[model samples]
Target: MNKRVLRIYFLISIVGLLAVYFFWPKYEKLPILETVSSFQLENVHGGTYSLNNEKIKLVTFFYTHCPDICPMTMMDLMKLQAQLQKEGIFGNKVELVAISLDPENDTPKVIKRYSEGFSADPLGWKWLRGSEGDTKEIANSLKMQYQKLEGDFFSHSTTMFLLDDENNIRALYDMAISDNPIDTTKILEDISILIEGY
Candidate 1:
């Protein structure tokens, strides 16, 4: 081809590529790490709670007494829940589960009190506690770590995991760390996309 013709074709190709990149509808697909199917625990009401594949779930580990991250994480999720509710996607499409890492100290009553302090909607969110061994196993399966500290204190990672309707781990949010605040908006945007898929 002539140089002029080749240059024209290259320009057209670049425009086409830019159009596709800019105008295409992008749906983010989160990879499935593993299926979470087996877990039984006690809810804040002291009722039996089980994890299954029925609903898209947001799971996080926290202890009622966590000095900072735990409360901040849940409060952030509280805002997320409110946003989802405003969009009418809170309960029918998604649910949130906050599991107590210090189950020995975070009894059903303490879980209830802590959740209420955050104004958590119990109908849409659940606070859970179980035996220390069972809770550790559950955390292990989710790849979250927590260690006992001095005098009813604990050190734990701050992570929130998103599970699909089939109970597959789809995404995770590091809600908080030692020095940074959690990005709840991005997490909610991702959850909105997932809910849209359902």
Candidate 2:
């Protein structure tokens, strides 16, 4: 009887310690990251997209003419959308915004066609394009810098941003590129965290 009682005590202690370790106050105390407000962007097919408009939005900047990084970036976001749809909360609860840096080439027609190509049913997706100066200001505000390269090629980040309804940048991610690939499961997990109270 004493041995059984001691074993029970040990098991309870182990469980308690695990609970403490996993759900520590210190872990909970880590502050939420701040986000930026009020930005504007244009999508690959050409449409107006504004940030911080009272929704949980995922925004990314890319140019259609991009030979390498842009395609990989879009694939990552599309994959993310698929994962979120499986969860059944991404489209209605979150906004997916894509902005294009190559305004000259990425017109509204192009964006529409692009969306069709990207997904048969592109739910909660907004492709944006605007005046070059306006787009520049928005991109600069987000600390995303880009410049036109020679020919039709451009260099830009494959990273995406999460913005709150109030125009704050809540989270950022490097979507899959040929050189670097992030874990899709982990990316979905992080996005789920920002989706709270949205």
Query: Which candidate number maximizes lDDT?
Result: 1
Residue-by-residue lDDT tens digits, candidate 1, 83-121:
878978677778888888887778787788888888888
Per-residue lDDT of 33 in model 2: 59
Misplaced by over 4 Å in model 2 are 1-34, 40-48, 120-122
lDDT of 2 by residue, 71-105 (tens): 67677667777877778866577767777787888
- Lowest-lDDT window of 10 residues in candidate 2? 26-35
TM-score of 2: 0.74
